[model samples]
Target: MMNSLDISEECNNAFDKILKTRRSIRFFRDEIPPKELIEDIINAGLFAPYAGLAVENKEYFRKFIVIPRNTRAMEKIVEITKNIMKVKSEAFKSEMDKNPYLKKKGAAFSKRLELFADKGVLGIGTAPYYIVIAEKRGFPPVQQQSLAHCLENMWLKATSLNLGFHLVSATAQMAEDEDFSRILGIKSGEYEINGCAIGYPKENPSESSRPETKEVINWIK
Candidate 1:
């Protein structure tokens, strides 16, 4: 049997590998990951930090609604999301046009918006599963932050599972859409929503770079 120090070193090495290897993958194969593995990924998110005090209801504070590809619900959410993005993209363009700084800084973003507005988010249909996460709204409406934490957990879990994951960020703006909210069995604006697409990657992911830990850390007095 391994000693305690050896066990600790082994865990540290495994963690470092996963943290360094995690990268956002866009292109995915049509093949689906096992349902059991997907459930494990969702479970990873469910245990993520939540606003215990800020939650209006403790019981239904968080929900994971998984929609499989090529289904009517998937079709409906994609349509609803596209409609939402189309409106947001137009407004974003108008804002960018009027602001010189914004126009310059958001050029790449504007291109992405154009594609999303026209065809919907890329990974939604390409991946076999579109997972929607909903966090109930509360006093300060800090649900979005909690939703973000949940997604990050799911993202890391997916990376560890050798699954490609894409953030469907546009779904964050779908809160006020009554049609979209109804599909999730929640009233409009009652909950903050976010989504992600997950599947097997078509190709191996390239290495992702980041600043050295020492460079980012602030050893303040």
Candidate 2:
């Protein structure tokens, strides 16, 4: 039998593998994740630490809106995202025209815009489930930080369950549009901070580049 230290090291290795394998999935199969699995992921989010002690406060409320395979709702979201992409592309093109440096560096941005147009949505994938992370407007930065932790917990949980997960930050703008906000069930004073797409991945994506620990960290004596 393995020693306790060996067991601990094995568990650590498994966690590292999960962390490394958790890529931002851009394509997913046309299938919905099990409701129980989604509930477990949400439970992970709920278990994340918060900033304040007041459980009743709006700031402490962890709000998540799940849209599971709703064709009409997805259609509306896609339409709004397409409109936003159009406006952004036009704005970027205008800026690029004035600045030669911007014109050179913005090739990748232009390509991404084209891809969004082709996909008919801002998200990286056509996931069967879309979750909107919303919070009360004008909340403190600490509250936002707490929500971020909650999201990370959910991401890890999804990865452990062999589910695809991708953060869709671009769709946050949808919360500003009255009709889109209404469709998403966002209250008048609430703001959509982030969004995520979840489903079973069609393909396993390669790992993305990252900076070395030495470059990103500082050692203090």
Candidate 3:
């Protein structure tokens, strides 16, 4: 019979496999994942790290908005995201002009910003579902950190289920947009938001490379 040590080793190995297999999947099949499966992933997100004492509302602190592909809602969000990226791109350009070294070193990033400002991300509508996860702003203002934890949990859950996942990071900057804020039924700046796309992949991409554990880990005595 397997002992407790054997069970612990098995669990650790399973989790390691899940972590190593996670990838940022951009292209996806058109088929929509079952509603229950999506809920399971979102449910995983709720269990992530949160500042329980920071917010008074225990019942409705975090929110998730799920939109299907090719819908009017998706259209509005895509347009809003593009506009926000445009503002971000312009701000970066202004900074680049002010600093000669910044302009030189930021050339590649500027190109990426231009792409976002112009066309937005194709994965927004390519995936069967676009999910916006919003965290309620609190006194300490650690909402973004909480949202990051929430997303990582959801991403890992999706990976374990063989679903594709992509981060729509521009959604974080749209909190102050009047039109986008209205869609969430919250006042501007009331929430810190992040978004992601999830669905089955069209083709499996290889896992991303990572530095050796010894290369990055630091120990303090």
Candidate 3 residue 178 Cα shift, in angstroms, is 1.4
CA lDDT of each prediction against the hidden true structure: 0.85, 0.74, 0.87
Q: Could you tell me how far off, in angstroms, the CA of residue 193 lies in candidate 1 after the best superposition?
A: 1.0
Candidate 1's residue-wise lDDT over 1-221, tens digit each? 86656667677888778777778777888787999989999999998999888895487789888888898888887788788888888998999989999898998888888888789887666689888899888878788899889998898888889998888887787889998888878788778889898999888776679888899999989
Query: Is candidate 2 or 3 superior in TM-score?
Result: 3
Model 2 scores a TM of: 0.75
For residues 122-186, could you state the per-residue lDDT of candidate 2 as single tens digits? 34237878887775555345545666777888888899999988887666545567766787677
* Candidate 3 backbone collisions, by pair: none
Could you tell me every candidate's TM-score relative to the true structure? Answer: 0.88, 0.75, 0.88
Clashes of each: 0, 0, 0
Put down candidate 3 lDDT per residue, 1-221, tens digits, no spaces.
Answer: 87656668678898898999999998888788999989999999998989876666577889998888989988887888788889889999999999999888998888888898899866666689988888888878889889999999999999999999988887787888999888767778878999899999999978768999899988988
lDDT (C-alpha) at residue 184 in model 1: 78
On TM-score, the stronger of 1 and 2 is 1
Native-vs-model 1 lDDT?
0.85
Q: In candidate 1, where is summed lDDT lowest over 10 consecutive residues?
A: 2-11
Ranking by lDDT: 3, 1, 2
Task: Enumerate residue pairs that collide in model 1.
Answer: none
